[model samples]
Target: MTLPTTAAAPPSAPPRTFSAVLVANRGEIACRVIRTLKEMGIRSVAVYSDADKDAKHVALADTAVAIGGTAPAESYLKIDAIIDACRRSGAEAVHPGYGFLSENVEFAKALDAAGITFIGPGIGAIEVMGDKIRSKNHVMAYDVPCVPGIAKPGLTDQDLIEAASDVGFPLLIKPSAGGGGKGMHVVEQAEDLASTLLTARRVAASAFGDDTLFLERLIRAPRHIEVQVLADNHGNVIHLGERECSLQRRHQKVIEEAPSALFESLADGAAHRERIGEAACNAARSVNYSGAGTVEFLVSDEHPDEFFFMEMNTRLQVEHPVTELVTGIDLVEWQVRIAAGEVLTVAQSDVVLQGHAVEARVYAEVPERNFMPSMGRIVALAEHGAADATVSGQQPDHANVRIDSAMRDTLQITGDYDPMLAKVIAWGEGRTAALDTLDAALGRYTLLGVDTNVEYLRLLINDSDVRAGHLDTGLIERKLPSMEFRHAGPRELIAAALTLWLERPGSAFAGDAWKVPDAWRVGARGAWTATFGLPGAGTATVSVTEKDGSVTAAVDGGGPVNVRVADRSGTGLVLEFDGGLVTYAVGSAPGAVREISVGNDGWSCRLEVLDRAERLRRMLSGIQREEGAADPEVRSPMPGTVVSVSVSDGDSVEEGQVLLAVEAMKMEHQLVASVAGTVHLTSKPGDLVKADQILATIHVHVATEETANTGQNTDKEVHP
Candidate 1:
């Protein structure tokens, strides 16, 4: 089949300030670049993978080019394809947006050789700073306070243990060429050193194509701070203050803010700022850095005066918006100007940091379920911003909120890329105001269909420790597991139940119906189950019961809920039966699912029929009743690739033993044995398994008939 195109011959006009720019990225960042281009009156060109044909960024660009396959390696990282895209789109420059080929020096060199301007630091700077070991050596040469560690690579397990001992207990074993905490492990004692090193090396090899690792003395309760720097080709550099990124989980930053409170405690704030700023400048100068970059430091809270250079990101960071908000400087514009042979517009002394800014990344992940990446369609996204805020009249400039997002009401959150859906930022004159604004915005922002960490973010912003600015890299790890998954209030639960009930099949309110029989049953009220199409992009089942003339419903899927409905009489239904009042509006038809539009919170629920709902329930009931069965079967929880199988047929295993390991979405999970019995494994390593697939079975030995019956009853209770 011939592909459709609106191709035209190249323009005959001479180049007018970068006629076009090729965005060598995807998703929000690509969209961000295109927005900047449009502001500068430059045409924007977008490149897409096979999977991103319908992505938001592609539709937003002036022109789009399809590169290759869905995966990063096959498309975004393919230098030749990117260069070809630039040529096809008549783009005079290429912008590598923070990932894929952003830090790849070879790609920069290739762009230079192809005579296309790369809108970032030059190839030399990228080469120097891309290698962590080399960058460490370069920074240390300038008397920067470097982390206490060695830069050598390829150390044996014994050497690693000895290095850890010298660095002291609780040191970090990190890959020599790593960032984003990949291939890094924390060793609490000498005994854990060897295993941690091996794991780190393996992970590093797979991720960065380097198995070399290094040791660093982990600073106890260290807060992560990074200074944003912009430099021109004409030997001028300025620091844009610091961002405090202490709230992180598994070495990934979830929240970031500007002008840390810890900075205020230092005796000589100006002097300390100058010193750190100078160090960051020197580090940038070491690589002859130009354009926008961030120099990260791990500052010790115990010894507030002391700080060590962590690493330098050669590209714009994911959390650069907070800096932009407080400084009122567009880093992207500067990057474009610098690449076009422009001199520095602002001097170091001219730069002034003002106000407080906080940014929270809203990711498609379940905070209650190990922060696992979630993927699906964003049925509804309600983003709270200054444009939608109420005027409080307290501060003249207190609009306070900003949302940077690429998702719309019907966007799909695919599993093929990063799970971050949006970045929400709040700016205020003081820290308290910023924190309060951020918390309130989070509370008002509503998302449906996929799981997100919105509630978790709210918890963090409200926590006494976070509010008081007592933050560190380990804060989330120390507090998150206990904080997440706590029950939502009864009101929220009732709202979810009502949402489910309204979306059930045969419910008089199935469509956009305004009225239903006063006491009409929605479905088969006896253990009835019907799927509900949620606003976000998935279907969930609602089990309804109608015993003793009372209606009861339970939602059988994850994520939050917001339901609103009204009756034909124009009276809003105050669904207060489930401990909360779910305000709803009546619709014209039963097919018109309940939709809730509160401020920026937009969500809807559609009723659907589930063919297997009844069958599954019957199967579960039958399994529960067969309590004295001789053999018990085990099933898979989710679809995944089996990474390992530890047991074979006839292998005796204790309860809670790991029977197999399955990998899904780059993370590993173990399937544990639920009973102490002889294992009969049905699947082996490297097999792809589906949810509820019988992976294994176990047989329990019983001494007597009575004891067997008792054990069977116990098994049924435990499994159920």
Candidate 2:
């Protein structure tokens, strides 16, 4: 079923609808806002950085202005440039869609000074509620219960350590600014408190521009629930129910839904919903807030009735679609209407919750590898569902299924912004139906050429605890160890090899098998061995032979299995492997000429078809390197800038000591020592390194069992 996103009705006097409006954002949210603007008959102006000239949002808007820079600070965050664009375009209002300047008080003030309407809460409200420390202190007077913590301005590493006991053990260190769990860390024990604070403060300063942090008691088995509140300039405030956001990893929400399943299990669920909704409204009223905002709360799974105020998000949340789908209210249209000075026509009694809706955030990440951010070109794109993706605009290529995305063919995914590509939201008559719809949609969400978390998301949503709504903040971490993620097996490997070999110019697909390159020949039985470089330092060798018009393939010299390719298109291929028909999404990117990507059943893998000479060289080199010897080299796992280096050159460290951190795509990965030895560093802070680039080498001593046991250790036995 489609989510009805009709524009709001015309409002009364003292204000007028603007003919044009500017959206100061990028990516899917920008595209989402422009859709609503079109429905309202308002001209939408899009501002883009240099990197986004070909982005979906820019093409969707009626007019586009290039603020012109790839980095956020150079373009989207430039307040003066955005104001100038608005003035030049004759736009009377601007929608600060979430991230960039949505909660920025100075940006709102600048708009007001320029005589432009800001489609959000007032500057005072943004200022008070933007900072987590201030918002927590401000809402307590209104009787909103807050978690016990040492929350105040200017708490340093020492301040937190000294007050650690007062706050209690197992406390959380959180940055007062920014959302999305960017600079948050949990200190489980007293011994790890100081070092975590140092890293937390550095990350906070780098991310939020303010290192101001506070501490909170880590709620055990806690569920994260947030209530959506909408307030107008005319003192009209209402709550749009609540969203269950407990399914998260590292405090980053992975899945969210409306009408908490935990609440539905309660005896008097309606009363509890009303109480929580009223509490959210009370928090909004205290700040004199206006426009769409979310009040987040932490509730324990054991005691579903008891709740505590966590922090109020002063702007629209990434999970707002679920609220819109369940309530049948277009929040963006209302935001524009409110900014145009409208009064609330629908009362609290008129606000009714409908069917359940669930949303899954699809990110460009490798979940199997600790959720590493993936960046590349969109080589192939296809989506399947009953309905077309909600659109009023020119996001030319996206499949059906209530998808809010800026994804398209050939669009480049870079590290300049967040790795979140799109959101897949589904609705049904009941919670079970909604969850089932969501899972099916995720399975149908196909994308290739870049690694994604889609497969892991399916595994997660189908988990026994998740399906049963045994939810908590730590549930994802707890379930991750037991979750089995699918990998590219024999079918995928053979498919990749055959597709690459068959697609050449003098190719096997051309009817003359002898004309094909590699090991093709016109003999009674044609046989060839192909080597492929798989993901994560893996390699697969497949031997193929053609006889009697049927192909049999053996992987790494295993038993032969039947394989057949029935179809091949620009985007995918239909193959019958081991007597089972499967449609595989296939693609290749310019950056990788020898590489090809293949996908099936919500999982995808990229493998390189190595030449015969290259494969032989690698095999010889691999043999030369001892298999069980301690590798002295520490390579960067990903391409990113070195944010922090913990150890100095020539410093002796233990095997597990933290050496440095690499930051890419808004996520940070800490690299640790591989073995106990003296580190010979090659990289330092602020160095931009590439994937598998050696950052350091640990000089270690290694000896054979015979030499070590005989106490004949010599300098020759030491290895570096």
Candidate 3:
């Protein structure tokens, strides 16, 4: 394929400044790009799916276009829809924000063919780096040190086994066409090679539509490091130091830090940075790359001198903000300028590392449930004030803590997009200061209704291993079993109990009674018992008994405790009892009350009664029944397409046997028989199944007495 040469400026043609650019992506990245365009005096166009019609990014954009259905493939990934949106909206350029089509070679080519400048690397660069095998070979050609691996095509099962043996145990099987850790597996022993290969192939085939796999030697206790590179059409390229993305879950980065602690630990830190930077520059120059790109490497923990190339992301990365914080450069602006036939203004010598910066990706996910994406309405968002604050011995004003978000209280978080809600970044003169500021900022941050990984991120920064920078891709999994949520102390608990009790249905101050001083109990004590729902946290029911002079409360199934209520002149009621203290400042209002509670541990909280019926409905709905009575028929656990049905009607199968396989989210889940029985297949291969669909029936074989009893129980259960 012949690459398009950089066009020279025509004497008669004027430099065209785009009036508006259509963001062909969703979520934070879309918002990030729009912010840059707005700053540059350019109008921004947003495209959204049915699920994101009212999203924050859509509202923030100058104009919005409804693309199509909710799924990415139908909306954001639809090239024609995006192009039409640009044409209809008078958008001059199309910015495919990372993910959907950001690095897609065909997408870039289509944009070029349509005479729309794609705000990213050229199609040639994207094509060269989009394929893992091709990118690996290209990087190696530049003498860029890479992980010893095979990128050759067409490897049979036996060939892969032999290659795995040659690479030795503890190797990685990765798809040559995949990235983001998808279609990747780690084999710890020779016996696990075959299974790992099958799994990797299956996932790769499903995700990238390519089943070819490659092998690489696994680096033990490796830290993920990547150097940011920017290139111009004028053959100018430079490196922007490195960011440490060691904190990960299932190979997905959760937190990233610039000027890694691992780098500082080296005896020759300055020399090592220069070496890595040069290699990264060479890799970019080899591809004649343009715009913002990231060259990732896996650095050895024991030997910091050794590093290997992982892959090259041909666009701005999710954690690019960390680099921006330290370098003080707007990568998006540079990408636009460079694409406009501009020269690189900043040289390698001009690039300076200012301070330590850390960024935590706040994802809408349940950490307790293996980080599954959580979808729901965002009820509230609270963030701490960014001011001069000393944390972890570093002053934020001096270190600089920044919060970049594209979320508002009214937006709905749906599963159709990436689960990330925001990126919280903190900078400090040193590692301790940076981490400390981030931790403090995280503690003050709050999101309600939908579960977030904020609490988990807080725990991770405070963890002993993370604090010491002993991190790897497997850190989350290894430490998850021992991880626990930070709990509200006794003082906070007591205050919460008192607040809920005071706001109970039968309380003395019922519906505007607080506004009438005459309604106050001259010397009467009021008491009530109520349940307080904690959402993700389990509920706690408490009984509050008030006397003429004092109030006493007892938590459900617990001992009684005295409560001290202090009246703050105009603030509200401050309840102090047990080890917790909370302040309820509802004023003299007679309607719903909003209460604030502060634990002695520094985790402050607020509770508000929005609607009684709605709250009750939600609280009751949160409780899920166990297994729905366990029907004898095997059902699909999630929405997916059946790949193959292994059994037919009346075929005898053993317990724990695979009945069929369903693929969802690029992972294959096997629907297996719980008991040995004759299978009655109802769904065939390639059939689309919804969650809880009865794929097959299992008729158990038993003795005469057992059969009679089983039949009776089955009839009752099925009928009930």
Could you give the C-alpha RMSD of every candidate to the true structure, in order shown? 9.0, 3.9, 7.2
Candidate 3 — which pairs collide?
Answer: 490-580, 491-579, 491-580, 491-581, 492-580, 512-590
After superposition, candidate 3 runs with Cα above 4 Å error: 1-16, 154-159, 385-399, 487-540, 546-551, 562-575, 583-720
Task: Give, for candidate 3, the lowest lDDT window spanning 10 residues.
Answer: 385-394
TM-score of decoy 3: 0.79
Q: Across residues 1-720, which tens digit of lDDT does each residue of candidate 2 receive?
A: 111221335455665788999999999899899988998899999999999999989999999999968989999999999999998888999999988898889999999999999999988889989999999999999989999998889777888899999999899999999687778899999999988998888998999898999999989999999999988776767888899999998889999998999888888888888888888988999988888999999987888778999989888899998888788788898889878888766567667888788889999998888898887788888765422244221123322247888898888887779899989888877888888878887887888888999999889888888889899989888888877877779888888777765665554464654455556545564567778887886679988876777788889999998888888777778888767898888887755336778897788877777777778877885786678755678998777899999999989899889999999888989989878877889999999898789999988756667777788855232554
lDDT for model 3 comes to: 0.73
lDDT of 3 at 91: 87
lDDT of 1 by residue, 521-628 (tens): 456345444553333223555555555556655666433233333332221235544355454322212222333221122222222333465446645755665565
- TM-scores, each model vs. reference: 0.80, 0.94, 0.79
Model-by-model lDDT, in order?
0.71, 0.84, 0.73
lDDT of model 3, residue 98 = 77
Error of 1 at 570 (Å): 17
- State how far residue 101 of model 3 sits from its true place (Å): 0.6
Model 2 stretches with alpha carbons more than 4 Å out: 1-15, 385-400, 506-516, 521-525, 703-720
- Best to worst by lDDT, what's the order? 2, 3, 1
Quality of model 1 by C-alpha lDDT: 0.71
What's the true lDDT of residue 425 in model 1? Answer: 84
